[model samples]
Target: VLRDERCTNLSSLIFATIFFGNLAFRAYYSRKM
Candidate 1:
């Protein structure tokens, strides 16, 4: 149970990082254009 919880948290963190990164990239790209 503890291991499963840790894995879930790690996956979520990674997902959030990627999501935010994508948003930032899009914003920067639009600004550049």
Candidate 2:
């Protein structure tokens, strides 16, 4: 159970980081344009 929780947490962190990174890249590209 603990392992499963850890897995979920890690996935959540990765997903959030990727999401934020995409948002930042989009904003940067829009500003450049």
Tens-digit lDDT track for model 1 on 1-33? 999999999999999999999999999999999
Cα RMSD (angstroms) for every candidate in the order listed: 0.4, 0.5
Candidate 1 weakest ten by summed lDDT: 1-10
Colliding residue pairs in candidate 2: none
lDDT of 2 by residue, 1-33 (tens): 999999999999999999999999999999999
Instruction: Supply candidate 1's per-residue lDDT for 13.
Output: 100
> What TM-score against the true fold does each predicted structure earn?
0.92, 0.90
Superposed by TM-score, candidate 1 places the C-alpha of residue 23 at a distance from the truth, in angstroms, of: 0.2
Poorest 10 consecutive residues by lDDT, candidate 2: 1-10
User: Which regions of candidate 1 are displaced past 4 Å?
Assistant: none
